[model samples]
Target: MADDLKFSAPPVMRSHPVNPTEPIDTLPELLNHLHQAAYVEMSTIPMYLYAAFSIETRGYSQWDPGVGASRLIRSIVVEEMLHLTLVRNLLVALGDGADVTFYDDKFMPKYPSTMLHRSPPLLLHLGKCTPDQVRDVFMEFERPKPDPLDPPPPDGWYATVGEFYRAIEDGLRRLDQTMGAKLWAGNQPDLQYVAAYWNRDGGGKPLLVHDLQSALDALKTIVEQGEGLEPGEPTVPVDPVHPKAGLDELPHYTKFQRIAEGIEGIGTLHDFRTDPHAGDYAADAGLTALNTLFNAAYSYVMHMLDVIFRTSWKDLKPGESNFRYHLERSFISAMQGILVTLAETMAAVPAGPTFEYYALPEQGKQAHLIELCDKAMTYFPQLGGDNSVRWLLAKLPDV
Candidate 1:
């Protein structure tokens, strides 16, 4: 039977435009910006994960710079999650439901892609970002600010992530003058993440926009964590999650630079790339089965998130909440497992090939979260083999 699916209009996720200098004036514009914010927050996580994971698993925590490089890349990926949550919190406050599975083409990263269509654009790829790639591409993407000559639209729109949110902050303040507290209509205080979401990840609260002050704080948190307090300067704080992380960790941009510097200091180049290939594990490579399974597993994650987001936690019965939470844990765990599967395939496959990450049409789009999971469950045997059996066992509810 043909799969039945009809998706809502994918959320607006555009971040740049010809008139980037145009300040946001209305609610639609603000929502559009928040949608863009969600995409921007999401786009970087996979890239960093790809790199952090591609390092020989054994080499992780082995060599000084290698270990440091891997740790830094991964830590930044976690913070990006905080940023995503903050964006979603803002969206819900603005009266929109957030969707993780909405993999629309807009803001969908293309390798050799510039984030905001800036001049001398930082060409990005979805593979291992090494020394050269880190400096030329990743650093450029997270640069403290954009160049003045390229265009001010970028300055207002394409510049540092901080500046982008600054624009959003400005919009919120402007809109507040007219809307007042009515502006936080979509706000859901209950959905806001505490330290628990991170598995005791020790970060501060997700951005909750109940008023101008909270909105600005949320934006400020995103900027300070990623871009730092000053332009083009380094600020290393202890990993807030760590017990002894006192002034030891740096922001994403700085972390990339540290890897680059570490590589050079060790008398070799970290060289992330000339163009992005999914390193060796690319699903686009000849590894069809592995690729399919990887995508399936990843798609399941989106489904799990959709469940949590669509329904309030408090509304769930104990059994349902427990089931949902454990399902989430399984899906999250499967993410790394899928990556490992691809890595194994990469090793076995011949040289000069790439594997692309893809979730099929049957996997469903943004709205079909539950239906998709049910369908995906049937394919567990082929998609996950023995592991699927374990997930199946854990998922059973006591009648």
Candidate 2:
């Protein structure tokens, strides 16, 4: 069934052109930009996660750079997730739902590709955690928009991720001031996923954005955590979540810089190939099965998110479980547990899992992914012996 499934590209979400130089004047334009923001945030996850998974922390001490590096990168990935969720919430607050486009050909970028709306295109790669990669791809992605006084990009596009988001922030404020309550006329409060469902210990909690103030707060957390304050600026005091964890409170750019500058050490890294593709292992059944399982699990998580964002929340009766919570648990477990394990295994194979689109027939319905999991167990018995993955898939929402 998995093999017979065809890859389908999702319908394009952008109905209007995005010109950063012009102010967003209409609700449709703003919604399109919000969709782009969600895409940018979602696109970085696999690139960062692949590197984090490649860092072999087995023999490294807690104080070693390798151990610290993995923890640091993983934490950034966590914050990125928060950023994505906040953007989704913002969309929900504004009457539009955010789409998870990672599993579609039209939406998901082929690695070594630039992010949406980024001019002078920064090519992101999926590879091992080498210093060169840290210095180049990761750092560049989080780089601050140089020269605060300079005008916006002449091409009407952004040069940095920070700049792209700054445009969105400016547009949101402008719209709120002008449109007033009518802007949120289609707002669905129940569709907004709140902080209670997110990781508080991660970068920051997911914020609920109903009004202008709350929306601004969400954007503030994203920008501050990503770019930090520019040089020569007074540092804002952060209430550290883990004071002893060292660098946990620092912005992502700072953390990546430290590792790139050799200020922090990293343990042994697997020789995983760069920008791997699913077709790279098509000749080997075992590797193919592993890759399929990994991609299927990934698609499943994203589909669950689409459901969460579009579907309204409802109360449950006695003996009935909340599918939303189940979906959330499945997402956390699949990313941290299943995906991580598969990544490490692929690294050991020296091939690496391709973060490509994998479609399952009638996706988001639960049964198809469970079937894929069963086949994966047949191919790789140690993937939580009998029914482990099946149990996980069973709990996912069927929307």
Candidate 3:
């Protein structure tokens, strides 16, 4: 079980080395495929965060952190996260139990890498992404398909994340047909999840995937949001309950386009840097320190998720009352907000890497901190509402 989660998990973005001719037919291969799906989603988070965080907000008022560039890139990051959750849940529905791990030590992508090593032909840098980068490069990364309805590209290797998931979808269908109910032997609804954190970040409810239809919804949510297009379908996929944003009718690629092109009512035009900011992180002392803190915080978030999965799958426990269950979710929610702020802070501090994921050497210490916070929650009510997160933040070198 630990081996499955690892997925060669440590040096960052491990390769599956698939055999081109054969489909992902067996259970083990399916698990490996899901693990790769997790990697695909994991690969994007920091890259988009770095770009969004690097936007120049010198004279922006409506959107303080950023208006055009920041909003576009960050929104994609959120959806990428949604994509990751969907895949992890799918893994549990098929197998791996409810405690399946979502990520592992080598979860982070290197400073310069590619999505599935094919989505973008160019090497993606973890630096300040400029308007030109967004228009010329970033937009292309999530660029719409030449034909939205085009069939999945030839198997073996995928040129885009969509094509990759399309292949996975094909595998899911074939296996379901051959194995029938056996394919979803361990389907667990309790483990399923859908993230509706923001007004615009809606659609695709969490599902129990025991059958074909349910599985399709799960897969479709990932693909459609990533680059799905349905005529007469609103692009943003809003959760009617929270409609603060004017229109939620665009996919990730289109959202980036709005920033690259500009929304008439929102703001004025800007130029893509001819000589974009490489964000030479080593040059700045303070920014480097904050980035390190951000990386640690990011790893802790991963650790919390790891605990939640191992507790459920390995130890046979899963519930809101479970410390791992509660803290993992709470920490993620807290960290999401913090990430937005942290990304903004990185943007403010010029010439710095946004954050990078490294293996947390003292995971035991992290676990201890979670335990300490849990103890504080039970015995010491005066600590504050978010003692764990607050304590984690306090660990940074200085304010």
- Which structure among the candidates has the greatest lDDT? 2
Badly placed stretches (over 4 Å) of model 1 are 1-19, 57-66, 98-108, 117-120, 147-157, 191-196, 199-208, 236-248, 263-286, 318-324, 337-399
* Tens digit per residue, CA lDDT, model 2, 1-399: 111111221223333245555878778778888877777787788898888777876445475534467777877888889888889899889988643343565555457665555544566789788899998888878877654654554555676777777777888888988999998887788877773455443567777788888888888878777877564332322422212333336677777887787666667887778998888788988888888888877776776677667555565567988766666666777676667777776677766778877767774446766667667667666665544555655655565
* TM-score for candidate 1, residues paired by index: 0.73
For 50-89, candidate 1 gives per-residue lDDT tens digits of: 6654554434446553545655675677778778777777
Better of 1 and 2 by TM-score: 2
**C-alpha lDDT of all candidate models, in order:** 0.54, 0.71, 0.56
The clash count of every prediction, one per candidate, is 17, 3, 7
Better of 1 and 3 by lDDT: 3
TM for every model, in the order presented, reads 0.73, 0.86, 0.72
| RMSD value for candidate 1 | 7.7
Order of the predicted models by lDDT, top scorer first: 2, 3, 1
Q: Which is superior by lDDT, 1 or 2?
A: 2
Which residue runs does candidate 3 get wrong by more than 4 Å?
1-15, 58-67, 97-105, 117-120, 146-155, 194-203, 230-236, 239-248, 264-288, 311-325, 361-364, 367-399
- Which regions of candidate 2 deviate over 4 angstroms? 1-16, 58-61, 65-67, 98-103, 147-152, 196-201, 232-248, 363-365, 386-391, 394-399
